[model samples]
Target: MYYQCVKLRQIIIAVYLSISLDGVADSSGPYLASGIKIGEVDQTSAIVWVRLTHEKRAHFDKLPILTKGLKRNEKDAESMPEGVARGMAGEVRVGYVATNEKRAFAWTDWTQVLAENDFTHQFKLADLKSGASYSCIVQVREVGSDKLSSTTNGSFKTAPKKTQPVPIRFIVTTCQSVRSIDSGAQGHVAYKTMLELDPHFFVHTGDILYYDKAPLCKNIKQARAKWNLIFAYEHNMNFHRQVSSYFMKDDHDTLKNDCWPGQTYGDLTFDQGLKIFREQVPMGKKTYRTIRWGKHVQIWLTEHRDFRTSNRVEDGPEKTILGMEQKAWLMRTMKQSDATHKFLIVPGPIVGPDKRGKNDNHSNKGFSNEGQQLRNFLAKQKNTYVICGDRHWQYCSKDPQTGVLEMGCGPVNDQHMFGGAPKADKTYHRFFGKKGGFLAVTVVDGKAKAEWMSADVKGNTGKPEIRYTELLGSR
Candidate 1:
């Protein structure tokens, strides 16, 4: 009887989905490159992202012609011209509603068409109630037609108000290499577990997509193609549909290994890479910013690639990783924040000693002077911690000198490549092998507890074990 009931429910859900899709389009070619996703949610606002494909043939002929003469190597290039040919132009709008109840949906006015044709549309939905869940629908229509050509649905929850005593829970993860996805792995197991856990939000530390490495993306067209393929994956789409996410880029996703601004490789320049990164990801104008989850948790998201000095430069007090402006912003934010728990999310490990020595320029040891300064500042602050990714293993450690705990969340689906065995870091209290998983953090009052959940190579995650528990602030 129980099995029969479950089967009937599944059938009903399938029919409902079919009906919902039926209104969007008739017999036509694909209209959406990627479905809707929610990015960068806060107490009263959120960003909705959608990518639209051309409904008919592309409008490349409308583009202005290039007047400059091409270099010998560039003359043979066909990809850039092809990319221009694929451009589309049309109108798109998003309608959204916020409610505490599941069935009660009262959609607000349709937003202006923010983007058109082979482009990403990021619609900012503001003036929402704090800590409320919202459901949204995106619809695309031709320039003159009143009928909608495409529609997709997604949902997200706003952060809690500053005065609210809401308990905060979130998941942290990183490193989804495209190689893993292409190897015929069914779907990421860790993502499946995350959906079941259903945290308030998800944090991707960095390496969101690997473009610089094997099966390298050499041009803008190739980079965009990679982005499309990554987003089209079932696991990624399913995860983003239900949970709001914060994203940052690391070396592999940007340009090359240990990449920084001004570095050029093949046909991909840093500017081009940056452009694609910003367009594909749901981020604001500035990459490094802060998100407050009521009075209990404050997260500082940092950008590691844009302003840093080249890794080849000699190490000194002048050598920096976060760069000058971002470093200053981080310090000021940390000092001024009154949240019970302050989290500084970096793209690489900030506390542990990397076994690779100076080659690990992004790690703390390579930028020791700046790292020490930041650590000293954090030491004086109450209830501060550092959460990092880029390392392939999980570790819970405290800086011996500053007593700031740094928790490393392992790769999401990529093969664990480094930091498997416990290195000789005296500050490290717990270490897990090269297994892909994420960190689940729970905060109550001024205290926070973290659980390091482990998953196998195939993405099968096991039970989450308590890794660290402590008072966030000095009482």
Candidate 2:
């Protein structure tokens, strides 16, 4: 029954569009409102995500937010009628040129964007040079016509091969809510701060958006509207346009709070949320995978919501959050990798002392069995660390049982910071703060470094103040 439901939803999404095919040709504007996303970047290849919109930017006008009892095309009954960037049918092609070289642009074949895939396309750019910066040019045209409607520009850097022992810096963050945006008029200031750092790459651990929060997204239309509204913000669009990023989804962004498989939030089913996430982002077939930045850094990104037993289930050897296959793969890859530093990127904390009421993540007692198993495995590894999201506060801790290190990046803005957990958990906490910021990690020759800094809501008028810093000697 579940599989059948999934198949039906997939078909519906494939044909869903805001405008007709004829409208695209006659329409004056088919813009790149959501900007572009570069993901799954490796030494010689990367995936570039593009979406064509009906307007130059998102509709941000005020409207009566119909949180419940949603109706399509109902001006007063729709929650975000003015916030959605209506998708249009068009043809998109991307071209690239290395930043350091004065060479002709390498262009890819034109691909059609339709409602079936939200008028978005991910173009795979292969045969790229590692450790090189590249400028991207995206051109869009009406279907069956050579006349270009729009051309957008962006840039990214590819990772160096394992043999290239180059120093690299990257940022990791999580738990961003549209409602809690530091600058409602602009976007989250964290993007600006992180952008200024000029890191080689970035990773959003999860909770990219809140589907259950106000202006509640109860249906597919509203959910997609929420996504459009977020990326429409000036800061988000500009940063993503320039930086290569890896996006992951957790409870709130995936379905709801503490969400698991086979769950539904109002009219939005679990499967619908999953489909929308993949469509909105540039993702591969699987969520859990690893990427090596250079000889010094190798990062593992995990999937938390896909294959997990219910939180209500009793704790034992069978209770799992990463499932069997992903867990085995993670262990195998970590053991085989010869990188000087290995970082495990997860949606939730593994060496945490979370609030007593929570029960979903490894930090809680509900999944202690697997949590302990992972901690034990990580104990023997050298220069390996766990980087997690979901917790609203920034923290750095070491497991008392295994001496494994873990760092939480905290929420996107200062307003979203929570004080639910104890300020001091001496047993595990090395540093803890009820503030909003991001974690910057640098992997290089003689040392592995980490810094946690805070950004203000007032457009980051002040510079990011580093609160804590850790420097580990050579491996």
Q: Which candidate number would show the highest TM-score if scored against the true structure?
A: 2
Q: Candidate 1's residue-wise lDDT over 1-475, tens digit each? A: 3235324433543543465567665624335545567888998788887766654323223212111212213212223233322324445676666633546444444433333223667778788788876666667665555666776666677899877878788889987754444223233556766765657788998887766644466877767766755565456666776678998888878887778789877888888878788888788879999999988899999988888887777778888878888888898888888888889888887776555543544444567777778778878888888888887777777777677778888787435343344455655555544556788888876568877775432224344444434434442
Worst 10 residues of 2 by lDDT: 66-75
lDDT of each: 0.67, 0.81
Superposed on all Cα atoms, the candidates' RMSDs to the truth, in angstroms, are: 7.7, 9.5
User: Against the true structure, whose lDDT is highest?
Assistant: 2
lDDT of 2: 0.81
lDDT, candidate 1, residue 262?
A: 91
Summarize candidate 2's per-residue lDDT along 14-132 as a digit string, tens digits. Answer: 33222122224444757888888888888888899999998887765544232121122322323445346888888899888776687878999999998878788999899999998
